[model samples]
Target: MAIDEVLADLKQKIDEKLPKGTTISSVEFEGPQLVMYTENPWSFADNGNIVRNLAKTLRTRIVVRPDPKVLVPPEESVNKIVETVPVDSAIANYHFDPDVGEVIIEAEKPGLVIGKHGETLREITKKIGWTPKVVRAPPISSRTVKNIREFMKTNHKERKEILKTVGRKIHRECTSKDQWVRVTSLGGCKEVGRSCFLLSTPESCVMIDCGVNVGSEEHMTPYLYVPEVSPFSKLDAVVITHAHLDHQGLLPLLYRYGFEGPVYCTPPTRDLMALLQLDYIDVASKEGGRPPYSSADVREVLKHSIVLDYEEVTDIAPDIKLTFHNAGHILGSAISHFHIGDGLHNVVFTGDFKYEKTRLFDPAVNKFPRVESVVMESTYGGVNALQPSLQDAEGHMQQVIKNTLQNKGIVLIPAFAVGRSQEVMIVLEDAIRKGLIDNVPVYLDGMIWEATAIHATYPEYLNNDLRKLIFQKGENPFLSECFRPVDSNELRQEIISKREPCVILATSGMMNAGPVMEYFKAFAEDERNTLVFVGYQADGTLGRRIQKGWKEIPLKTGKGTEMIHMNMNVEIIDGFSGHSDRRQLMEYIRKMKPRPERVFTEHGDERSCIDLATSIHKKNKMETRALTNLETIRLV
Candidate 1:
């Protein structure tokens, strides 16, 4: 049957199931949802279970919206919302999107706007004829979030059309019945960067994690030239596991190559992906390198994004149901679980997961309804890769900072702008509050400050302790007074020149670019200063070279290359990395509910990947393979 026939059958069934007084004006497909426009939306308002029952019976998500003809004017709707919602909700802004018949209310306290069991929201919708979408206003303002929200509102019509097109394609009739699933590693196999994979069935094709390697020019992007990945438009969907450049940097390149499918991820991941992609272009331009994709391509990606919360089962293709589980590697990092052919097979891809808990998030989820094949990362899966406990790592870090401050010297810590920066901030704040370390100035340089602001915006995604501190206690560690933002080059220079004992956190975690290099150049010759490594440093990066005890390093300068002597103290505090170590990886597999029949290891050095695969096969008596780029494996 054609897609129109399928939708027609669904609409007829829906009309029959609806309440007696409910009248359907139109039925439309919006992405994965079937939206019904009604003249009287309140007919079924007394019993919310009607929609749930319809959804279960149809085996698809359903959304009911008032017909546009019945909707109140934008101005009148805004006035009614303000009057209905309490003043203490701290409504920061109101945005009306007529295309979706939604009035977005950004407030500091979204619960108050929702009222008990969403009574207030129902009242506003019934009164104004617009669905209320409540969003929490970030305590720390985020320019990226604000820009994305504004762009979404302004382009709602275009976005709605895009969704409709995608919805038609997703719900299209499946032609083939030969049920088989195959996965191809386009990149991020026996390597730590450029993570990409292609999952294909007879009915649909999907790509996961289009990434780039910052440390390598020759092997930067995924194997897009592969025959299986060519004609990018053939892909039905693209799923991003996180906002990290290694997982999503090359996403915009898809849009540049004529791919118009929806990109699925969490809300924070969408915002952070935009921020990182724009910054990637700016950094490449400043460093005199050509960016692969233009800013316009990034904007296209934003318009096509479909944000999903964790554990929300969504259909991106006719044969696949995608569910995201917490990975605990970063804010919004997810382990993608694909249920294919209505449980004919299930594949779980662990994208750079941290099986152990951290200050920022809970440990990676090991439980799933069903899984047959597992593809996991082996970033720290080498046999000897054992890290210290979190408590010991924090203690060591605190002592190092304390000694550096006591000696009246500055401390430089190069951390990833997203996860590591926020984790370090929490640790430092706790140490200072407990008097374990001196209360010295902690300067946030480069994109760390902006990334920290984004972290503050999503406290609910953080660990339990941190969320309680922010939501209940009203004490956000990210807003600690000791952390200061360095926004100007002059301030950076002044901090470098001054002998004041302070702690500095800068971005470009591998020291390939950004403000960390400026501070490193200034502090390299100071014997009393300290440089710490709190995250993974890829090979060929300046950070890795320094870790190898390179006494003098040549660096690019305006006048040419110059050599700088290294005299500062260097510290490598283990256990702070977001990647799970070998022990944790093995333990995760052991603890997994309904153990997988086979496992594939990737996202590590060649030796690490091989070793992990071998160990898992030997210990669990399961088929295991360490795949390389362009290798295809048949799972079903």
Candidate 2:
């Protein structure tokens, strides 16, 4: 077909598939390539996947132009589609290098063309010609680790200066010279998880979210080994944002020290914490003595908890009012909003949030009259952490389970006692009811059964659609007949000993610590048994070691310690990650109305944190910082 015919055909095909309010403005031909430029390509953000899928169906390549000004090739066929995009007003600073057949586009805004893995360059090349290698005007010296380090120090110094200015403005309202308030992070300055902050005024001292680092065991102190002489204990309240271990794991240990204040969180957070702490205890017991804390201590911590509803703001102390908002990470998980002082200051702690909606939670709420400072989780700080769709995750999980059960082989699912375990059970139960699997016993050991009961009691905390399905439709996926809750240690041992082909779901998803170890020891030697991990496992943990395809595990059993040979199958389903990916995090930050003045990236690896900080500064022009453990930077 001629170029004009191709352009007309492409326009017609796109118009047919697209919903209302989209139209192609024109088409053009550049060299041998063809392009169909659209006037309204904002739909690409919402239906990009659909466009790509349609392209494949039509046996053509479709590239959504990121910029509207880029000229489009008109010769592209409707059926033999080349690419389409929005034309932006910006001019390309650098074009392709003809010597290497590389597309070297220079950028005034260098971040956009580089995207999350040079996606912008890839898109341009897919639509135009060869993959473009982006190059900018060279500096006097090449960019290196040394240069970047200097750049960061300079940036940090500048940020501190800016912060001092802001802090002075904030402190200007102090009525008394002796009584003043300043803000600073106790831990997690740059990264996401393990967010704890210290807010001090002459009349009040408050600490929020006593969290443990999930990334590394090299330095895993709950508060970076900060000594608690009296200042730490004098705090009015130690509030937890959610039940995720990174957020709530270390609260019990606070009671081990001299601190004896209320451990405040949601009611479901209380119940989930018990389940998590018990599992933590069980894991520590198997690994030998000196576990973090005992079940007794956890019980003590629970007694000190003051459960508050989402919108009901409760005064924890004379100077602090606390409220919980749906974080959308998991059931009962909350983004803590603190109204400090008498209309003095407000700070929000997003424990672990999901801004985008998911199968089990609502989107993160962003409504507050005042929010002076915000602490957020950065688990997906690295670009790679973004997730596939919920449907894809479920479908992938279904396939893994279905394949494992087909051979009548035992499928051992090592899941966290909290959210992941419950989700997997629901998926399995649905599959079984759908007659997708053979009649096989499905066992629920560890704290999962108890956790499910807690989940049942708190329907309002769950996603709106899920609650409606359970309450209105009367569908009991959690209480399915196939799910046999192992009530006692003896029952668990019996189920492990039984030679039945079944699906066993146990706690401590990482196998670092939980009942999963017992089952693993019993079945590790059997080739028919499959171990599936659905969450991130810390390094040096048993789960991480096993997932790396270790054939031998040194384990201490009831009889004694011994090195066990293993032939069990192992797999990791990565899409179920609750934390947002790097892409999602950036988008979330970009969308914040009246954007935050500063960004601290954390809850990720060193590389992830550094990369995230760079992105924040480059893309948003925000003063982003990444701090090491125990490092403190005064806001004033």
Candidate 3:
């Protein structure tokens, strides 16, 4: 069927289902959703089930919006909203988007803004004829989130058009009938960085991740020059599994290269991805290096983003239906599940998943409706790769901190801004509250503070224990008084000069750059001070070098290169890792529902990948392979 005819038929079906005398101004597609603009917005007030039943019949998501003519002016609507909502809601801001007829209401307490059973929201909508979308005002403000929201509001028209274009493309007819599925590893196959994969069927082509290898000077970007991914515009969509640089760092390059498709990710991932990309550019400029893509490219990527919640199934292309499941490695991290060609096959890609639970999130999801082929990460799949229990790890970390602090020395923990930083915060906060450690100042440098602010905005995405602590018990660990934000060189200098006992968390987890390098330089020669590694350090990174007992390190100085003697007490706590160890990786495969027929391992050292594949094949008696970069395999 033609596009126009299909839309007309859908409109007719909708019209027949709506109540009599109700008029729909127009029915339009808006990126995996059918938006129906109604002249009588109140028609849906008493008959909510009408739209629900229609969605069930159409087998697509439906959204109801007031017609442009029905919506009141922004000035008048703002007044109505202010008068209707309770004063105790502590509304922070109001943003009006006429393109979508939505008034975004940011408040300290969104529940109060929504009222009991959405009564206040309905009242505001009825008063102004604009839908009220309530969002929480993060306790700690995030500049990245603020900038993105403001940009979105200012460019509503352009964003709307982008969504419409994406919607039309997704709903277009598929002309191919030959059924086949293949996957190509453009990078991140017997290595841990620059992760990219191409999943292709006759009718659709999707890129799973486009990342960078921050540690390697020779190989920085994924193999976009490959014929399968060249001209980047041919990709139907790009799905990001997480916000780590190795997972989403190089995404803006696609926009720079003429790709105009939507990027799919969870809400937190979208925000964090923007933060890290912008930071990447800033770092490069400061370091006298050239950035591959500009900030304009990052904005383009954000404008074209379509955020999806966990388990919400959406059609990305004519032959592909995509769903996200929690990956437990980081906030907003997901395992991509693709249903292709009318259920001909299902593929699951576990992107940097942690099979065991952490303080920040639940364990990665293993159950799926159906999965015939699986692509998994083997970052910690070596034979001796077993981590201590979480309890032991926490106790060890606390004891180390105590010993350092009691001796009047600072503890420097080089952590990633996203997952490991936040995890350490929670652990430290709990320890302080329980009097397990002194209430010393915990300093947050680099992007750790900003990243935690983003975490505060999405408490629902956290683990159940943490969520309840935030929502029910009113104890948000991220907001503990012990934590301090270091925003200037003056404060950093003061902290180092004071010689006080404290714990400092700095970013650039691998110790390649960022504020952690400065702290490492300052504390490296102090035998009393301690350096902790709470996360993985990729090969070729400075952190990995230190892990391998490189005592004399050459670092750039103001005058010339200087060698720094590392005398600090260095500790590696394996249980704090976000990636699953060998045992957990095997357990994930063993517990996976409806066991897959074939498994491919990636995202690890060459030996680790090969070991994992060999172990899985021997233990489970299933076909397994460890893919190398640029290898292509046909599944069906």
Number of the top-ranking candidate, with TM-score as the measure: 1
**lDDT: the better of candidates 1 and 3:** 3
User: All predictions: root-mean-square deviation over Cα?
Assistant: 1.0, 24.0, 1.4
Q: So what's the TM-score on candidate 2?
A: 0.67
Which run of 10 residues does model 3 get worst, by summed lDDT? 39-48
Error of 1 at 360 (Å): 0.8
What's the alpha carbon RMSD for model 3? 1.4
Greater TM-score among 1 and 3 belongs to 1
- Candidate 3 lDDT over 1-636, as tens digits, reads 877788898999888888888878888889888899987876675577888899899988888898888888998888888898889889999987777888899998899989888888878877888888998898888998898888888888998999888888889899987999999999899999999999999988999999999888798889999999988999999999999989899999999988999999999999999999999999999988999999999999999999999999999998899999999999999999999988899999999999988999999999999999999999998888899998999999999999998888889999999999999999999999999999999999999999999999999889999988887788899989999999899999998888788999998999989999988998899999999999998888899999999999999877899899999999998799899999999999988998999899999999999999999999999999999899899999
lDDT of 1 by residue, 1-636 (tens): 887888889889988987777778888888988988887766655567988999899888888888788789988888889899999899999988777777899999898999998889988988888878999898988999889999988888899999999999988888896989999999999988999999999999999999999999888889999999889999999999999998899999999988999999999999999999999999999989899999999999999999998999988999899999999999899999999997899999999889988988999999999999999999988999889999999999999999999898999999999999999999999999989999899999999988988888888788888888877888898898999999999999999888689999998899999999999999999999999999998889999999999999899999999999999999999889999999999999988998999999999999999999999999999999999899899888
RMSD of 1: 1.0
Model 2, runs deviating above 4 Å = 1-195, 212-218, 224-231, 278-288, 291-300, 317-319, 341-345, 558-561
Q: List the residue pairs that clash in candidate 1.
A: none
Q: Backbone clashes in each candidate structure, one number apiece?
A: 0, 24, 0
Worst 10 residues of 1 by lDDT: 39-48
**Could you tell me the lDDT of residue 418 within candidate 3?**
95
TM-score of 1: 0.99
